[model samples]
Target: MTLQTVRSDILAGTVVFLVALPLSLGIAQACGLPPFVGLLTGVVGGIVVTIFSPSRFAVSGPAAGLVTVVAGAMESLGSFSLLLSALVLAGALQLLAGFLRAGRWICLVPGSVIQGMMAAIGLLLILQQTPVALDTDGDSVTKIISPDSVLVALGALLILALWQTRFIKRSRFLGRIPGALMAVLWGSLMVLTNDYLVPGSLADLDRLSLPEIDSFSEVAAQFSHPEFSAFWRNGAVWLTAVTLALVASLETLLSQEALQKLCPQQPQPSADKELLAQGVGNMLSGCLGGLPITAVIVRSSVNVNAGARSKFSVLLHGLLLFCCGLFFETLLNTIPLASLAAILMYTGYRLAHPELFLRQWRLGAVQFIPFIVTASAIVLTGMLTGLALGMLSQLLCSTCASHRSAIQLSSYSNHFVIRFNQNLTFLHNARLRDLLAKIPDNSVVIAEYESAEYMDRDIWLTLAAFSEAAAARGIMLERWPRAEDPQLVDGGVH
Candidate 1:
């Protein structure tokens, strides 16, 4: 690559790291883990996954989707140490899934369900961040607006405004700024100046809660290991691990697909390789007292949009997180929780944007209904519940919209013209046979399948049986020519 490309990637990497810094902390807090655990996972994901990831531009880190599950698991499982057992198990399952070649089945999942999951996650982010944004201390999913969080959220929102909108962004001077970092900087500046000017007025406000570390000994004290003893009898833990594996894999696959869509020229990523990478990441993170990691779309998009040329940018971002954790923990801790909440809130907005819903609607009810159901179920019930309902809708509607008979037959006075869709398989064999059976005795049948890319062996065998029946009934079948043999269309008659 050119030196200019390297420079661009580096610049993009720096910006992504800046965005990641506060988010890791925020997601960790939401998941009931130590703040550093989030950073630890982010760092591990960057350093470990880059070696194996097939996506050239996608970034990996702790995801927001698992927050509710992880937190609930922690509450029911009794301890963070015990939670690690589930994380490790989830990683192992992911590794096994990759080896088993389950990655290719990702396409079998309906698009509406994926969109619904994204929308639900977006809503979840906004709900979870509301408390932190307002400086309130309990769950805010039900209570979205808190009186206390108003000022803090508004201040952070203003920072987002300056960085995102025309007021400051329209100016060439401010266009280059990263809005998330600015929000953090502005919040910290307020905290710093408030302490100096008013002394005690803002002292009670919630700030970034991190380990008070001055030495290696203090840092080492925070390290934890998974509870190996409980692994054999913990049925609930196994369920949690399985849930984590499924959700993490689904989200990673979705992100990888989205990344491919954004960078269509880049090589398509292998789902199996990504699963393996994540497996390795989670295994290590669990052992080292960190949260589970997955492919994070927000950071990945930032990396790509910032002109990143390769995975080197992702590697560098991880290195930055590690180095910053080691040497600049104090500076990092000075960041306000409210600022991080704003960033997440913005990220959530991107995921559940109204435009996404509108686009799904334009795709028609077959798509929109499942999307809406998934979003509503996740919001009203939970993630898994929402996904179940969405998948049901997808399967029920798929017959008319997605999976359909490939062959179309047009009848003439004495003959019939048969047209085959690009993909012909066993799924279309039944329909094709029914159409063929309707042909009258002594009819001239035009069997055209020149466009069929893949005709299954079963389909061919079935057609052969039908052609024998047609021959006994005195019907003559005409062959259509293509690059491949016409046997599939001519019913093995060559």
Candidate 2:
């Protein structure tokens, strides 16, 4: 690569590194794993997934969308090792799915449901992290914030907001600066300055706790394997694994699609390939005691907005994580949890931005209803349940929304044409028969399949029989199919 290209990749990677660090820590804590595991997932995802995936701009990591799922799985399974086994199983299933081309059907998922799911996940992040941002741990949802954290978090959010404004985006210098980096750096610097002043306050602050190492050589020793004690013996564990596989694959594909929209020039990712990459990453992560990994949109978006040019940026980001984990783990620990929470809160807000709701609302009821239903359902129930409900809503709408081409009838003088506009399936056979019977006496009826390339033998046979009874119905019947010339014989084209 050219020197300029290397510099650009380094710049983009640095921005992504700042964004990924706290998120990795927070997501791991949410999943009941140590901060180290989450960071490790990011490192592995950037390094491993980039090697397998075709998308040049997308990045992978422990996704915020899976925070609840991972946390719940660990709680139910009763062991982090058992949870790791589930992740390993999930990864294997994803690999199988990719091999089977299961991801090819992703287009069948409605965009409305996808949007709704994203909004729901965003809201979930905000709700779950609010307590952390306010610097209060509790059994109750509403806890009074610590006086010190309130300012730290607010200031961090404000800095992020200012950095993301249109003015900054249009500016030559500010545009190049990542908002996440500015927020985190400013917040960390202020905290460090205060800690320097107070001497002992740094020891009492809630910081990201990570094991320290002097060099990159120690990184290998930190890797840990999963204990597959509950495999096969517990159906629940298998079910959870299947759920993880499906969810992780879905999230990865969806995030890939979203990022492609932001950078349309990048080569589109193959869903199956994406699935394979994620599967391998998850498997490796489980082996290393990291939380399950997916192509994360937040970090990917940050990478894009920071002007990522190629997969080099992804590789560079992973390298930074690896280098940081070894040499600067202590400095990262100096970052207060409240500041990280603010960063997450802003990330959450961007995912479920109010303007997104407005844009969808303008698309009409067909879009807005599903978007609102999915978001509300997710907030009240959970992600999968909410998605199921949203899909059902869309199905009902589609069934009610009939079309003229679904079944049409035309007439010219004594010639009444029974036209199959597009689809001529068994499902429309009854309607075709009804229209055939409605042909007036002494009129010539035509069973037309000229516009439709497909039709079932069941419908064709019914037409054949009806043709024989043309005399009984006082009407003459004919069949016109593309496979043969128009036939006006004693019976149908059968």
Candidate 3:
């Protein structure tokens, strides 16, 4: 690469690194795992995933959307090592799916359903983090109330909100700095200030906890390994594996699609290749005792906006995360937990914003119903169950709509012509039979299939049976392009 390209990559890489650091820790905490594991996942996403993925700007890491799945799996499995085993299997499933070229099918998932899933995840984050933000560590409200913690969270949140304003965004220098990094810095600075001034006053405030490793040499002790025995012994492990594979693969494909839109100048990446890259990253991360990984839109967006022109930026960011875990654990532990909670709460708000709901509602019932149902189900039940219910609801709505508009009946006196307006399938067979039986006796009817895109054998059989009975009822039924004509293809309409 040219010198200019190298310089651009370095700058972009630094920006992405800054954005990923605090978020990674927060995501791990949200999943009830060690803060270091989240950073490890980011490292794998940046280095390993970047090496294998085809997209130039795609950035991989732990995503907020998977928080529910990861938390539930952790609880059900009852051990981090057990969860790692499931994660490894999830990665293997993704690898198999990639080899099978299943990535393309992700496009068939409705946009509404995807949005609903995100909104639900966002709502969950808000609910889950509110107590943390408030620093409510005790059962009683009086004992749980910690003014110092609440102040820190609110101050960090205010800083984040102000950073997103048009005035700050228009500033050339401030706009380039990620708001998340700034929030973390603000929290750290507050802790330092309190320690130097009135340390005993804020002693009750909780801070991030990490092992007291003095040097890079001791960092290896933090690495974890999966319990291989859990793979076969616990059926829940397999269920968790399936859930992770499906969700991670879907999120990765969706991120790739979004990246394509953001960087239309860049050639589209192979979807299957993207899946393979993600699979490998998760497998490696699991082996090292890290959380599951996926192509995350937040980091990728930061990478692109910061002028990343190659995967070098992503790789560089990963290296930075590795170094952070080794040398910066002491400084990292000084960050207050309330600050991270605020950051996560803000992220959740963005996902389940009022505007997102209003936008879906404006799209009409067909889209809004599924979107709301998916979000509600996910919040009330769980991710997989909610998605299944949402898909079923969408299918029912789409089928009803198709049945209403799929055919048209036009009657000119006793001469009735039935025109197929859309594709015919088994689902339409019953409706077709009902319409045919309504035709009056001694009537002349015409069966038209020229407009239909596709016709199933069941539909054709229904038509043939109607034609047979038409003659007995003195109703003459004729085909548009005679049945013997070459244009009348079998099982398909042209």
Compare the candidates by TM-score and give the number of the best one. Answer: 3
lDDT of 1 by residue, 161-251 (tens): 6676677767765665677777778778877887789887776666666766788898788778899995869897887788788889998
Q: What is the lDDT of residue 168 in candidate 3?
A: 91
Cα lDDT of candidate 1 equals: 0.80
Q: What is the TM-score of each candidate against the true structure?
A: 0.77, 0.79, 0.87
Off by over 4 Å in 1: 1-6, 138-149, 166-173, 264-267, 400-494
- lDDT string, candidate 2, 372-469, tens digits: 88888877976667888999887765643443346678899988877776656677777777776677889887766656666667776776677667
Better of 2 and 3 by lDDT: 3
Candidate 2 runs further than 4 Å off: 141-144, 200-204, 214-222, 261-269, 301-310, 403-494
Model 3, span 1-494: residue lDDT tens: 99999999999999999999999999998887779898899999999999999999999999888888898899888999989999999999999999999998997898898999999989999888878888884457776577888888999899899998999999999999999999999989988888889876666777877777775666788899999964787999998999899889888888888888888644579999998999999999989999889998888989999998889999999999988987788899889889998999999999999999999999988899999999999999888899998898888777787787787787999999898988888888888887887789999999777778677778877877776777789998776433344545655555
Which sequence of candidate numbers ranks them by TM-score, best first?
3, 2, 1
lDDT of 1 at 26: 74
Against the reference, the lDDT scores of all candidates come to: 0.80, 0.79, 0.88
Task: Give the distance in Å from residue 78's predicted Cα in candidate 3 to where it truly belongs.
Answer: 0.6
